[model samples]
Target chain A: MHNQIFEKYTKADKSSLIPLLQEVQAIYGYLPEDALTDVSEYVKLPLSRVYGVATFYNQFRMSPLGENVIRVCRGTACHVKNSSNLLFALEDALNIKAGETTRDKKFTIELVNCIGACSIAPVITVNDDYFGRITTKDIPSIVKKYAGKTKTNGVTVTEEAV
Target chain B: MVELTINKIKVKAEDNMTILDAAKSVGITVPTLCHLKDLVPSGACRICSVEVEGFRNLVPSCAYPVSEGLVVETNSPRVRRARKTIVELLVEDHPQDCLVCVRNKNCELQDLAERYSLREHRFHGESKEHSIDISSASMERDPGKCILCGRCVRVCNEVQKIGAIDFTNRGFKSIVTTPYDKGLNVSDCILCVQCIVVCPTAALRERSSMKEVSSALESRTKFAVAQIAPAVRATLGEEYHLPLGTDVTGKLVTGLKRLGFKKVFDTNFAADLTIWEEANELIHRLVNNEPVPMFTSCCPGWVKFLEHNYPDLIQHLSSCKSPHEMEGAVLKTYYAKKLGISPKDVFVVSIMPCTVKKFEASRPELTEEKLQDVDAVLTTRELVRFFNVAGIDFADLNDSEFDNPLGESTGAAAIFGTSGGVMEAALRTAYFTLTGENLETMELNAVRGTDGVKETIIKIGDKELHVAVVNGIGNVREILDQVREGRSHYQFVEVMACPGGCINGGGQPIHQKTDKVLQRMRALYEIDKKMLKRRSHENESIKTLYKEFFIEPGSHVSHEILHTHYHSRKK
Candidate 1:
């Protein structure tokens, strides 16, 4: 099923693994287990070694991402300004924990070290659009915006618990 | 060779050799943890820190290479303090219930603490929390006792190549666990329990069935019967401070009898029966061109591995039940019927030198009408504990013989403890059955040894058979790859999950050296040398068993009672 994804790197040696995984992840947004298995077979390395290497680097994600990706900044500036609480609030609003996608694949929450925007403390980026100085109270509406629902327009809000 | 100075002694070592290896060459005892002799060095544990002349910080002796003219101090004051602090911290984070731990006095951390003359825990009152994972039938995982040494992880990944467990999460919460922290049962674990053997602490342990066995023996309604595997006899003596290769078959029988077991049988008898059935099946396969390589199904770990990973190749597995399970089935059926008792009243317990036997006994297919064939499996280590708990002096116990009927076995059965033994035994029987005569010399020396994989072509009469023996579980990959790629067509193949087979089984006494396994192999060969009947077909008792109970080798009745099937597993 994933032959086309790994067709180019089928005969590649050990050194081509990371680039191949990157290419596959770029297409799928995350490293699926089946693709990793195919990569392991293609590179002739044990699945554990492939997985161990993939985990050592912070760039690789093991699970597929949801349609809407949310990156919550846990930088030193954000933490001091109660961004951790904002993260929890987003987790509740999206009904998904950090590093986990929602059951309906509508939203995903991730906690990253820094986004290089300390001036906008407690920032949460919904996709490419950044929401700066995000408060716990702002999590629901921000999640609803990507959930394709508007409370003022009388569109039903998504509150599915994982 | 690189010239280096270890503790003021000039030593010449390899260029890429680690400081620990260099020190050992010159008789310097540099302590090491998480440093397995083979495979890759994961120098995660910092207990092997050594002081160097130029380096500002103490270097982990296990990971650091011995450079030219490198001066290393293995036991300097700073190194001692650092090592002590590292061990103290490991102990502080670990549970303090050493008095009742399964590893107890045998743990590596406990040994270090004692060697350092640790009077009291210098650092105290740490959060001792862990979820004890006993989900696996063969083993247990105690996260509290784990010091994050990564020995088990390396063994599982590198040596066995199973990769059932790995270092999950990061930093403080880092643990050696199955993917997504799932129980080992649901994972791709073959239940080999090789990780348990490499573990320095009590983090990985056998899922002991001793309590259930004790309770079964105490039951007034049931008559408890015990069977000891061939490998258990070869290594059980080591637990009592006896020599590694000392064969305690007789003494083990006496100890079992003393412990109140009504009937004491040998799994060797069942091993003979397995050969009898498996050899005929091989002959059938060879003649009919069924599965090219009829793989032995004795090792449950290997069987599970094939079922989970190479699910398509399950056809190569022999239909014959493992030795102990076969014996357990006969004990509940033939033995019980002959004694005029219900199968339920005959409680079967197997003393195995394998942790996978515990899982094998629990396999639903091995049961008969909701009644398990083997009620309990006590590993060789658990048997030693049982012996101690019963106050039986195993070292001085008088030798005793096994009971009648199901107790008799041949030399071929005795050698089933070591690698390539099943092949040798089956070859002896198959050659005899096909040619109607035994080979001039009963021993087939070509397939015998500690090699990872041994391949040979033996001529019976007009037909030549391609045979191979694989010791380690990881070593089977090449041969299986050959099979998958249509490269080689082996008529018969033997596989053992443990490196040296059941003698060095995961459930055997803990010993680091591989040479000890060789000693046990020699012991098994000695048993073969002494026995008058060296082939499975020569056992009169087995012949009688077939004549009275099953009627024929591949009879439908025999298949019903002694045969089983395998299914592909979800990882």
Candidate 2:
């Protein structure tokens, strides 16, 4: 999809390549290696310098994203609510820690500070949707919903996991 | 000067001055804690927040750049609200023990609480409870009262260049501590106490010597002699509301006498003695083709720094003990014998402008006949407290002289209180001793002043003497790095752990702004410039002592009594 977009965008001035690459990354959720070559060819910037800028800022993601992205609120409000324990539980259930995607690419977890909603603290956002009043015990079943599975305990995995 | 307006009052300020400075020039007082003049402005404490006409939100006046036609409201409702909110937030987590804290009456936070009428805390939560670490011989650390102002971090890293302590964690849980929360005694901490001086709260304090001094005085079994450091004379008057740089030597002597000290001596005399030994040692090193750069050992902080971080360079350190401790050792030995009193009967006390001197006095090596060289160490501030306790009005006390031979000193001895002064003093003696000719100019101007790191080369006779002077630990790191890289240009380096030397030491009276401290430092240099006997060897008493007793400088007898060794600290 990025290659197709890059090929279509290359008709314009080469300087527009950075914006195009950023847009592609934003859509695809990570900057692929082929995208860097495409960016260097289209923008006329050194590949190393472009890669340097990409790595310098924490905002840019380099690897592929998991099917489900779990962002645990580690903000002061949530932290006081034992969000660190909730974070540990989520990491265990997903079989991957924060900032890492699972081996099967099924789930990824990230810790973030206040998303500005402190009322329902110890909160987790699954794929850009909020899940409030989350407990450590709720982590395993919640993660199973993203993998399209159900448990023997009759805990129904909601279709809309968020 | 750039013209600026604050709250409708126009003021002229130097170009590049901050709005806070401009406001201050116009007699407007802005509350601040982390801003020290000599130190780089760390906009950590938002107490100095002010409203600017064009800016949307309140900005820290301490760091905000002043501009032409700029309008600043120092105490507008919005500014007050922001300042109050910041102060309240800081107070929320702050330990509520101001009445019992060491800095109860003198703390910046306590003053702010009084200024803002903060009787009760609106926000309450679990406060940080860090166990107080008093393991370091020189200073104590109380993390519970830390405001996270970063003054100590800035002074240590940016000014001293030591980077011994830094902000370890993040946000509310963040703390200033050595890497891995290691005790300071075990870390590469120099025991400079520069951190103690800059800390706004009781988070850092010098270990007290008041009890020991009081006990000794009360006993009356021992003959107590109190020696005042050279720097103390320059700034001790400030605590009594005397003007900056007012000479308080006579009053200091009188106060010590009133405090039950049998004899009041001068540390300047020992400083002159230090010059004689250190200069002779430096020349000896040059002649023997030994370690080219002989480090000045007068600063305990610098001595500890070399012990911990640069133990390999220990051989380069001049073997002379600091004038304060050197006097203590001599008083217990030589003075004891002269007065026909047993060493046990003589209690040697030092009133210094440094907290590290307390640590230096505690070192087991500086002992004679199983008694410590210095029985008690009192900071300049502590001495002032003693004066107040004794009801001795410093201003009312008539000018008097220090007791006998130990009381006399040269101008070179006086400047030992400031950074680079020891190097300059040593050079004045060393150059004359080597060439056997009086120096045309006594002041070694190149090595003077308060630059963090300064270097100069002088052609003395046949040798081109390469020298470096560093005031703060941060500067020491850069110089040490150069030496480690085998590219150092200096043949001799003098390092003082405080930014402006002893005058601005960790034990000195705390100034709210860095500018005021710099002003005081400048006043000290001015006092140095006006002194009659500007060279250490030129002092009559020092010459007589050398001729009659020690025989010559750096002799075996002098070295045994005056010089010492360094130890490597496990990091």
Best by lDDT: 1
Write model 1 residue lDDT over B1-571, tens digit each, in one string: 9898888999999888999988988788877788888677778888999999999999998888889999999888899999888888888898888998889878899999987777777887646466888899999998878888888888777878888788765666567777556687887788888888888889999998988999999999889999999988888888888877998889999999999999999899999999999999999988898978889999999999898878888998999999999999998888889999999988999999899999999999998767899999999899889988888889999999999888999999999999999999999999989999887877888888888898888898988999999998989988888887888778899999988899888898985765788899999999989999899999999999998999988899889889999999944
Error of 2 at B452 (Å): 3.1
Q: Give the per-residue lDDT of model 1 (tens digit) for A1-162.
A: 667766776566688799888987998888888788778778876566677667767788888888877889999999999999988898777777898998988887888899887876867787766778667877887777779831133323233221
Report the number of clashing residue pairs per model. 0, 9
Docking quality class, candidate 2: incorrect
- Best DockQ among the predictions, by candidate number: 1
Which pairs clash inside model 1? none
Candidate lDDT scores, in order, read 0.86, 0.78
Specify the highest-TM-score model's number.
1
Q: Please, what are the lDDT tens digits per residue for candidate 2 over residues B86-196?
A: 788888888877767778788888778788888777887788889888888778888888998888877776666566677754566677786446577766677777788
In the order shown, the candidates' DockQ scores are: 0.25, 0.04
> Which 10 consecutive positions of candidate 1 chain B have the poorest summed lDDT?
B173-182
Estimated TM-score per prediction? Answer: 0.90, 0.76
Candidate 1 ranges with C-alpha deviation above 4 Å:
A11-71, A79-109, A120-126, A131-162, B1-3, B12-17, B65-68, B119-130
